[model samples]
Target: MPAQQKKIIFCIAGVLSFACALGTAAAIGTQLWVKGTILCKTGALLVNATGQELEKFIGKIQYGLLYGERVRQCGLGGRPFQFSFFPDLLKIIPASIHVSVILFCTVLIIFALVGAGFFMFNAFGSPYETLHGPVGLYLWNFIACSCGCLIMILFSSEVKIHHLSEKIANFKEGSFIFKTHSEQFANSFWIILVCSLVQFLNTLLIRFAGFEFPFSKSKDSGTVTGAADLMY
Candidate 1:
């Protein structure tokens, strides 16, 4: 490819990777990861409560990796809580897996930024060695792609297969109770998936920039002989 075309491809890839990184970071920090309703199961079965009374027992739950909001209709109104994977809900959910999801998300963002930097550097600045060259582009992008995919897969498993929302809704301590009526992965979760796809697409952009895939051997033609060697 021409030098101009290569520069254009790198610029496009850099922009895409940067956007993906920003979206993933926003998704991680927002409380819109999961949205659902929690029903006060205890209140629902109150002996003297009527249908209208039961209607007052439902509340909303919205949570993210670091914090969450819970609204209780029984009397508590809305409350926010911050929690970690180790000691809070680890018993109900796989702490190791959940923590891994967050870890990989962090890795994805870091690698994405690094990849974007390399892409821009190669596009405008002269690059010759491993870190500043095409090899670095492939390395960073590949790592970012892997991290993004892992984040989506691990988080999806926690939400869909493991019933994370239900577990949180039903969690209780002493006389306090939390019950879930319905749960779902929200916009932030979907946005992470989109970011993962975008990272994957960046790998294709890297390939299109005339850099050969790592570990593949290129075909070599026969070596040319000098006139003196031929005469000898």
Candidate 2:
């Protein structure tokens, strides 16, 4: 590719990395990661509710890593409640797993910002003979992508295996036992997946910009003398 074309590629990748960072930050603040309905098993059994009557015993729940909103419908009108993970949910939920998810999210955002900075630097400035060059681009994007993957896996396990929604629904309730009726990952969870895909795409763009993968080139040719690298 021409020097001008390479700059354009790097610019595009930089913008994408920055956008992913912003999206992840926004996602962490919102309560749209997991959305589901919880059924009040005890209430339904007591009222002998069947079919359409069961609607009164079903409630809605949604949450992010830190905080969320839950509405209880135990044969009565929905009662809304808000919760936070730090100190409020430490006793009932799996504290270590939840904390790990938050830690990975923070890592993903930081690495994404670093990747964006490096991409812009490689495009507009003189290239250094160190990790700040092409190698750093690959390193940062890979780390961000890995963090994204881990966030999805860990959170999925916490929600499905640990019965997160049901636990939140029955948190302070002494009369009703709630069970997960329906659940799905909401927009914010999918946003992290998209960010992971974007990071992978950035790697391909770096390759398309004429930079070889760090170790794929033969050791004898590691000190390469190609037209691709001269402009940088």
Candidate 3:
């Protein structure tokens, strides 16, 4: 490819990487990761409650890694509550897994930013005989892609296999009881997946920008002259 076209491709990849990084960061901090309705099982099973009373035992909940909002309808209208996942609720929850998810998210964000910077640098600046060259593009993008994949895998495992939603719903305080009805990974979770895909595409773009695959070499096209050439 010509230098001008290569520059355009690199610029496109850089912009894409930067957008993915920003999106992943925003999803990490926002409260739209998981959205669901939780049913107050205790309230529903109350001796005084009838079939028509079940509506009062349902609540809506939405949360992300950092914080969440809940509105309970446990027979006394709707009571709203907000929570943080840090020191306050970490004590009550499975700390290790949740902490790991947060850590992976942070890693993904950092690597993504680094990859985007490399892409932009390679696009606009003269990068030669340095890590910021073609090899660096591959390295940083691969790292960012790995980080993004890990974040999604760990979080999905936490939510699905480990029953994170159930754990959160079952939190208790004195006479208050919480229960889960339904839950699903929301937009923010899917956004991380998109970020991962975009990073992978960026790697493909880098490859298409005239960089040879690492460790690959062209086969010798000339016939071997053997010892005759040495004698000459």
Report the number of the highest-TM-score candidate: 2
The lowest-lDDT stretch of 10 consecutive residues in candidate 1 is 223-232
Q: Give residue 88's lDDT in candidate 2 (0 to 100).
A: 90
Which candidate order results from sorting by TM-score in descending order? 2, 3, 1
- Write down the RMSD of candidate 1 (Cα, Å): 5.8
| Candidate with maximal lDDT | 2
Please list the residue runs of candidate 1 whose C-alpha ends up more than 4 Å from where it truly belongs after superposition: 47-54, 74-93, 173-178, 216-232
Sorted on lDDT, best first, the list reads 2, 3, 1
| Candidate 3 lDDT tens digits, 110-164 | 8778887877887778775446777777787788888778878888887778776
Candidate 3 has an lDDT of: 0.79
User: 1 or 3: which has the higher lDDT?
Assistant: 3
Work out the TM-score per prediction: 0.79, 0.94, 0.86
The lDDT for every candidate, in the order shown, is: 0.76, 0.91, 0.79
lDDT of 2: 0.91
- For every candidate in turn, the CA RMSD to the true structure comes to 5.8, 2.5, 5.8
Model 2 Cα displacement at 187 (Å)? 0.7
Q: How many backbone clashes does candidate 2 have?
A: 0
Provide the lDDT at 62 for model 2: 92
